[model samples]
Target: MKKFGIGQSAARFEDRRFLTGAGSYLDDENLPGQAVGVFLRSPYAHARLGGIDVSAALAGDGVFGVFTGPDLRAAGVGDLPCMADAPNADGSPCYKPPRPALAIGRVRHVGEPVALIVAETRARALDAAEAIFVEYDELPSVVETGAAMNGDAPRLWDEAPGNRCFDWYAGDAEAAAAALDGAAHRVELELVNNRLAPNSMEPRGAIASFEDGRLVLRVSCQGVHYIKRILLSGIFDCAEEDIRVICKDVGGGFGAKIFCYPEYVAALHAARTLGRPVKWVAERGESFLSDSHGRDHVTRLEAGFDNEFRFTGLRVSTIANLGSSLSPFSPFVATSAGVPMLSGCYRVPAAHVRVQGVFTNTAPVDAYRGAGRPEAIYAIERLMDFAGRRLGVSPGEFRRRNLIGAAEMPFRTVLGSTYDSGEFQQILDLALERSDRDGFESRRIAALQRGKLRGYGFASYIERCSGGAPEQARLIVGADGHIDLHIGTMSNGQGHETAFRQILCEYLEVDPERITVVQGDTDIIPRGGGTAGSRSVPVGGAAIAACARKLIRVAAGKAAELLEAAVEDIRFEAGRYHIAGTDRGLSFAEVAFRAAPQGGPAFDEIDEFAPGQATYPNGVHVVEVEIDRGTGVLDLVRYTVVDDFGQVINPDLLLGQVHGGIAQGLGQALLEDCHYDPQSGQLLTASFMDYAMPRADDCPDTDFSLRLAPCKTNPLGIKGAGEAGAIGAPPAIMNAVADALDADHIDMPATPRSIWKHLRKLAP
Candidate 1:
């Protein structure tokens, strides 16, 4: 409750270095006697590898070492890990295939690494890699999820026949069916959630070296601890205790960097075998080919309603494409995080959800920003609009009528995820008000006169972060007045240093400049759950707050002793501890100075852990658009969001998160799409030229308003803000697009050409 407390807008201190180009990132890391590495990748999406001829490459100029799958096999290195072996609804383990560091006999994806070429320079490595020849017999591939999940589809792996990774279901299937069967009215709609590349500003890469029997990697990743553990224990034959992962300044992750890619393994293996540092940096084109994609869902949503228009039942069936093989947490991302959110903000006695995680010939698919939650919201919200059209009701009015309102505290859905807290109606009302729902008709008429079509859309989404994992933190206070905090969560682009510093400083009653936040270094921090699922602030901040409270208690006792008073008589205010009735007091700095030089240290170092239940952050997003009838180009005019994130740590930081999420979400709805050739499985969108990214002109200024309904589980009463905008924005935009055209459906990236076709088809 101090000046720089939870609600203050503290400028991010890390930005100073980033803005000035002083930040140290992985690509900037250089070690002595280091060699560069380049990969030889498969040209065919599905093929049987006949043989690999790397001898000529090893003998090339400046070449240090050449490695293939056989080399890694000979070196006793293990295959890549799946991380989570999720069980299907029937309690059978998901079909998991071996993810080798290098493709041996078969390549299921076009960009699968087949050879690693190491040389004196990066260019030399690249040059030498071209000399290596690989023979392949092309095989059939099923690129689309709809086909991949078919019973007779071309199998990607023997274990997962028909390419179905898992058959999962949640909620009461029988009850939902019965309700739908007896309903007075029902609506069903199907759509595709187009795939998206994470495309972090800095591409994924790593520099690996072995020194004194320890392996160290300087990488751009979301989690260093997991990478170290995963590499040492699962991939390489090295002691887990002898590994170090240092993630200095990661530009962004958006869930792609969370995977332990094959390139990391190849670099580490090559470094250890050659007894030199080896570095591998992915080019943007390579990133487009290999980075984990998100939201490739072929889904059908069926909502049941009574004559009165009250909700009766809801059912969703989705095919989530895992892409070639399972990334670490792909199954979990498509199921637990994805399906439970299908209910959104509605109350239904019966609901059923089924997700068939299917594998295809493409880069692996996993968490991206809002992950499964966004895909779920997009389906339900779009269907809500479709149902509104069916019943001749306004989207806003229908949503308000059926929303699980404020009185429903801790509402447990049929999917079994307990909503911690939410005010869905309040959020929707505020969003509609801010977006001028009442004036939309007039605006539409005005736009019609100008040969433009105007429309309004709404999406209400719920996000569950803080995935029941305990976060760790260690606080160290030096006698010189330096307060350092080591947390387990990596920043990955979020303002962790500034936000955590503000939270700690508020408790210690210290200046913001007094604290230094260190993260993503396994050698420095004992344990952590690196940032994903928007868990950093909610779970990580709770850990820091818990430890801070304990530290304050210790500091108060020490202050009481120093002031010759009982602990109860000591009052700590404005960074100083004073005896109740007198002015005798000692500052925190003085206490640290006195206690450190003496027997007991003034600093309290405690490792704080879990406040486990997931926090639900739900929101309503309104998007207004202007469509050019002549050219078929759509212009986003206004976007307004009202969310319940429980509490705000830094309003500016939260707003930035919302803005970035909206931009990425809008990118998916209007610009970006990761495409693979349906027949050949060749990745068509493999570079910036083919893969469209949203620019400044593509996004409208976003207005964000927070409706506080503090979460009951976490210590800070704060839910996540990281993914709210992305989860809610896409459906709103697409719904508006559908509205303007008076169409039942329009898939994502509602590109100008697609719009032109839709408009043309409807023209009379």
Candidate 2:
């Protein structure tokens, strides 16, 4: 591989515009004569809708439209369809509740959109929205996941009795039971992976315009093509081609923007009815209420281990809180995203996992950064540490003993996942070396002198990306000698433009600047599965490379014809096509010119690279923390991560992704939680003042390295790196805290109060 531009830490090309405040996000876009829409949300978690008196709101000055559920229903709009579906263990279909764009006869959760008030100005629409009267007969609501599964709790969905969406389990149960019965030592722990708000810098927004019998939607979404299909076929009952979904410069998605929100439907409907563009931008509070929250699972785990600290079997029964109506991807999240990755990087001989997707009176829980992998990592790694203490083995040594070895290539776990490739011990060794695990006792002693507890934590985690499905790309070499590559995957902050450009430049041997990457426009790009599950590089990047190769072939053939040489005799290298034993050659630009007839190139090609299966990216993370015993305030001093992402496309962007993911994971481990009052269903932490997001000062200096275990699945050998940091960081941080206090257990968000309470319990 060339060294100049392919693998180096090139500074991001998009950062200059973003840092200078010149980036154009959806909210920054303003159409001529655009009206603002403010949604009227339900305050009660469960309530019967008696009636909505919109007369006063309609009388408000500058109010153009007030749309409710009945209006949408009358307009022939259908409920948003769940994009992902999975069967139960018994082969029965999973329970899927109808998710209406606007609340129909009942409101199942707080902040459920009931009506949209469109006016000439944002403030006016908000004022009109406040004036709308909604009469509701409040019903008993269940906010807790466990309680929701009980018979006493009021049912949120009749189809799913006891509010249980599915009783799904993975792995061999009988074998796992037998292993547990014969194990030398057993350990059990109850854990909670707390719910979290994505809280991307820019809130969700949508601008809709209808003209010439066509609907154009510009929104802050991760999947524009997917959203177009959903809106046209599901929501508006229009043809997919009749609607164009354009996501222009999204601020950040982090899995929150991957779903179809009610605001989008409302904005589009308002524009169609009013014959003018309508815009709706969610406020910070609205974003907190509406955007999908992630990782609310109450799990009880039991692990069986032998005398040598080898894991024998594991059992986990978890209640996943899928709030109110199902989010677009809720079913898949519970079944596939949350369940498939239960076995982390360990070689457990047997395992059984029963995940019950339950309905609660709260915001819907969906994929966050690491999605299910983080929760699974927390459970397995915490149990590993606990087992280590019980077995009198060091945490690092215990992990090394049980980690899936390199010889276990194409290893299939009891949990039904075939890990294509990994070197789990290598990453752990690298992480330990980077963190200097041997010198940790001295650091703990130094911290103890200052009345602090210092400890280190380790986690070996694995994740599968590029698993969702196939992705498509279209690339063409234009007459101007520049290549235009169009892909269906949209970029939120992963630097797709720069990363994909590098792939194209490497394959085509063209200058990076000559390749123009286009994305997020449904009209231009072909069919594709949008970016999530860290599938962009292995799936989408491969698709882009496939297209580039096709373009090179076409260009080479044209050059052969122009040079009057046999196609096989012509060789293309470094953007030039030459004949064997001849100095006569044609530059890429000259070849493109020769291919062009009176108007343009003779042929334009598109390539769809379909991958067989997902690639597994595994890693180990070591976190060191200092706890102030007096104040119970924990400080993350250092975080070291060694990941096996198969191969590196861009080291700088990959590191940035790792850093950002660690921030989110650390927030979940020590700082962030979405708290709601059980009685009122009122959100306790709705703003930044209450929700503690990790800032620059909150994060420690990170040490990161990649273990080069190239995946054999993809052509580029790149596994997913987007979610690895989040998956590994949580366990590492939690383990470090537990090690610091020498405590047996600590809940997530190890808030100061929780830590203080644990300390009190531990003290004599």
Candidate 3:
């Protein structure tokens, strides 16, 4: 077999179906006897459910069943379980709120599911849902992160006091304070990472059925096995083996479709009670209210620098607004996701971070494209720019002086993370070169002549991926020389089929066309972690490689037997096994034919590759922006990204991931914000008309490239590339806007009103 070196640009193999509109999305599936399920949700953010009268809906013409909270509880259903269980700073366990599948005595947030109505069609289900009446006693709500922590706010849970879910701290506070006191210069700023919705092109949908004493479910999810475990064992009070889950071709997930939602459990329970299939599809409006939102952190940051612009210390206190009910991964997002990566790619001598996860009256917040890393990068990079302004230094020079050098491989940080490998300076240099930093003054002058204010900004970011315990894979050789590979990782439009096929072909010396990759089914690939935390390529791909190697070993033995040669003398290459000293060789197909009729040399192998640690992938992004000083509108002019994703397996796919991530990151920084009315708690930005999404015209031409460092932790020599763009994009664009305005502070989504207000304040 030949080695497929790092940084090779192989075209994506999944584009054919996607471009042809043949992608098999969950909504496209129509079971023979499927009934549509619609949800009746709460209108008020906080309210006591006085009564629910589903009798009218149950007796309607097309209504098959109407399930409420009481029905779910009567059938022995449990609340959804939170994944992470981190402790607070005072050594007490973090608050664990019971997230019931259906609203119990009270509803905590608007759009909280209260009842499920099943009918023959989607329209009928929706009509019946609206017909069901419910009475509520409205209660005061808290929608702001800082306000939620105030004593006047209403408590959302008894387990959590003062509406505080968790008060967590990382790094050495005393050392950070001491360094700050003795620093030559210091700067402080306040930032808000606004809330964003993961509007995957296709909204979430599910189809569930009960047959032959087992429950079968199909969803558009990133983690099919995890959903099965949560529903069958945790919530449904059934044996894990009795439930089967499958995720077909998903349009997109972006970390929003990774969990078990209430509708999923309701559909399955409805199927069990009615003895038929029940299907549910969230409309765009319902999706905006139900899908897990991202970011929403209010932070105060202070940065200390020496005389030479070297970063000395940093301090950050963030209040994370995790909506009314805790999302599955909220704890990890607030503490592990953002807090650990606060330093980004810089080498700060000392740093301290405190995160208070607070409850808000909105949709639950979880992982989006970048998850917590975007919030961290926004804070650190913005502070870096402010520090540079205070010290009268260029942003580039200040960052270059403080970035982690290439010599610091496997460097451990004060926050307790071991960066496996990265060349931080190399990326920064590449980004700067690609962005044409030297000629930016001319561009700004040109823009100024057109009555536009032009500015340039740069952000260097580092993130953790391929973390968690382990992943498993199974490799099987069929009778006709076809290869079947099974893994536990699910792909929701990340091109796992194409990229994984390349790895299997490179390792097994088999034709890519003959290899088949299957995933997102619990019954098929049992005992493996589902994909998240960007662990698929590095961790999951490594497991596949290990399984392929074992299969090759077994095939080599069979080839040796057929060729009348010693097993030690046989060498397999180019799909054939040859003897070392003789001109005798056997093709893999021929060897398989000879070994078959006797189980084919036990041609089945399973591998559980556990690295037991996470690898950090870092990069640098430079962006140029043109701000209309009069109108206060910012438009992107040029964007360049140089990322070090360790070794890239498929260059084309890696770049695609980077491009999509950057667009999302840019959206969060400038346009997209999930807004709610402070007084009424009504979601104001509900549709495309109100919500701002990045269109083709909105994104500037992008220049993207990769640098290779080859992480030593995984056998594939690859790190995760799923979320790097989102992590690094926001800070770069925001910093560029701040540079153009010459302003002391600016919030995200710098709308015209906000920018004009800042400009007016700067006026004499």
Taking the tens digit of each residue's C-alpha lDDT, what string does model 2 give over 451-517? 9999889888888777767888887667777777788888888898888887777766677777777
Over the stretch 1-764, how does candidate 1's per-residue lDDT look in tens digits? Answer: 43777888989999998999999989888999989999989998999998788888888889999999988988888888887766888799998888889998999998999999999998888888888888999998888888886776778888876788889888889999999999999999999999999999999999989888888888999988878778865687666678888899998999999878899988888888899999899999889888888989999988899887878999889999999988888988888887887888888779998889888999999999988989988988998999999898888888877889788888998788889788888888888898889899999999999999988888999988876678987888887667889899999888999999988877887877888898988888868889988999988898898888877778788888888899999888888889888999998888777767555444857767686679998888888899999788999998888888888899999999999999999999999998889888899999989989989888798887888999998778889989888898899999999888888888988999999988998889
Off by over 4 Å in 3: 1-8, 598-602
List per-prediction Cα lDDT, in the order shown: 0.87, 0.85, 0.85
Candidate 3 colliding pairs, count: 0
Q: What's the count of clashing pairs in each model shown?
A: 0, 0, 0
- Per-candidate TM-scores read 0.98, 0.98, 0.97
Q: Write the per-residue lDDT of candidate 3 for residues 373-447, one digit (tens) a residue.
A: 888888888988888887888888888998888898778887788887889888888889888899999999999
Total backbone clashes of candidate 1, pairs 3 or more residues apart or in separate chains? 0
Worst 10 residues of 1 by lDDT: 595-604
Give the worst 10-residue stretch by lDDT in candidate 2. Answer: 1-10
Superposed Cα deviation of residue 478, candidate 3 (Å): 1.1
Off by over 4 Å in 2: 1-5, 601-603
